[model samples]
Target: MTATAAPPTSAPVGALSSRRLLSAIFALLGVVMAVWGSRMPAVQAAAHLGPGQLAVVLLAAAAGMVAGLQMGGRLAHRYGPARLLAGPTIIFGLSLALLGMCRTLTSLCLVAVVFGIGHGLLDVGANSAAVNLERACRRRIMSSLHCAYSLGALAGAGLAALTAWAPYHVLFATVGILTAMAAAAGLPLIQSAAHLDTPAQPDPTQHDDTPQLQPRTVWLLGFLAAACLLGEGAAADWSAVHLHTLHASEATAALAYAAYSAAMVAGRLFGDRLNARFGPTAVARAGAALAATGLGAGLLIGSATAALFGWMALGLGLSTAVPSLISAAGRGGPRAVNAVAATGYLGLLLGPAAIGALASLTTLPAALALPVLLAAVVALSAHRALDSK
Candidate 1:
């Protein structure tokens, strides 16, 4: 038989440049989601819905996100990240606008699902692109991309808090406009990245040198990711409420999220260096320890300032785990993506629900501590994984 040509080892020229730009656009979208999503309490108040009714609507959003996560990998593989990124972003913006217009619970639930789908798709596309881009650059870039998301989130939350005095509809409309612009900016990156196309068939002459991953490896990473994500999810869903509980005013309550986002951004910006110096295993373990400690301390101290500090610490600690795990899985090979995505997304999907359930059964403070303990478990397991490897 004739020998087959080997796949190219080098990234196409300009691919890295395009990837950086795409990262920025994805960050912008993340900011919009944070700002608008954090304002849900106000939106519910505007709709005159009780807590029970509002919970159902929010659950719809979570369900939609789960659905998107389940399908995102296949879609990205089939259609490529560019189309997957841009199209869903536009849909996300439209759904944001729809959220502003909805008056009844039914309408809100529908909008929530649409928005979740778009959000989920955007996340998968952006993250996949970020990972691929980093691989091409042969340096640490995922942390920076995640930092962009944190920065965007910080800006969005800041802006949302600042504009709380304005009409709620105006706030959402502005978010929609910003997200649309971000979608437009991302379109070019998708066109230029040719490697995102399906991988060529294997060459018979080439040896398969990729490392083999045991099934336990998948579950281990999944467990760690779930715990790390639980910490993140707690901050995203409850920081503002916690602040409010601490007697902060409506506008200032958002600062809780802002602090967490800022910490996340800062951690991510510096994460590449930290990862380089320490390695992914060390980073994940340390991050979990810091998060668990910070969160537990914050809840125990029971001060607004302490809470903010705790949230920031939690953000910093949790920042690197998800990206690091994703990279590890990808390094393991293609089939690993499904397991990584499914496991990671499962943690992400369950975080809010678990917190909400805990809140219902006991106090929010006690529920918040659940993630701290979970994070501790993640750190211990991650350290073992690293040592074994």
Candidate 2:
């Protein structure tokens, strides 16, 4: 006798739910990051740490994130990204909440590691699932998903500011509870076990059941991801400084970062359509070119008002670069994606210091030109990096 199955319409329902669930996952990550960042000063004060000590703690967290990304990629490959998401999601929320209770450096370090692990795992799992979904649907949604993340971060940051008078523990607990609820709500939609039970579709570009990526190609892609992230890091860390260099008032300088962030949100929200119409390589190349042009213009103009426009343009230009590259990395499977993520993270570590070093050697505006050059490299090499050759 044949086994009875649900109606064919069920598949579409499941797919829709899965897509929503992926968006929720990404948003939750953004919320966690913003909440933690806003509450960082409190945590530091509780641990009685100075600026240098706080940097050490942050480095430890970064270390944990790197390790987790390494393991999360391999594990997600073996077990499936959907299945890998659940445990880490829960752990991440719990750790963030627990941060309020850590009164000493040792305890804070331990909790940070735990949170970092969760953060890294969720990052890999969610992005991996996004890639799979895009392949299944055969359209570009990565940019929209990232836009959701940016929106969530904005919302969380706003909430943190509004609730600044509340105790750290209470604020963190609120965020944690919300994250947990989101995870629970999305659990049924993930269908991770179902994915594991079923056979995976073959890659269109590959003949074998397994899609293999070359090591050299993987490294190349990793560097491309890193370059894109380098631009992102520079924008986040130095936008305000660049504005100040143009002799902007303190209040106007403060708006520089906000302008860049707003531009990023706008770019990502609309970028999916661009990706669908133009393709990833074209979109990425254009984005990089625009970023290079904007940053170069800002440096050349040496005016605060012009710099604001330049920063906004830079944000728009770099907005979709990482998403497009990450989606391409997903073609090689979870491990490949992880390699790319890890490499990209190295740029975040280096970005601030690199700018600082260059500033010491030259002028700040001159140092800021490095990201412009990097963007140009991305524009030129995007096709080579994205193709699985």
lDDT of each: 0.74, 0.80
Instruction: List CA RMSD, all candidates.
Output: 4.3, 4.4
Candidate 2 Cα errors over 4 Å, as ranges: 1-13, 192-200, 203-209
- The number of clashing residue pairs in model 2 is 0
Tell me the TM-score of model 1. 0.84
Point to the candidate with the largest TM-score: 2
Query: What are the TM-scores, per candidate, against the unseen true structure?
Result: 0.84, 0.91
Per-residue lDDT for 276-317 in model 2, tens only? 788888989999999999879988999999899898888899
* Sliding window of 10 residues with minimal summed lDDT for model 1: 1-10
Question: What does the lDDT come to for candidate 2?
Answer: 0.80
Clashes per model (N, Cα, C within 3 A): 0, 0
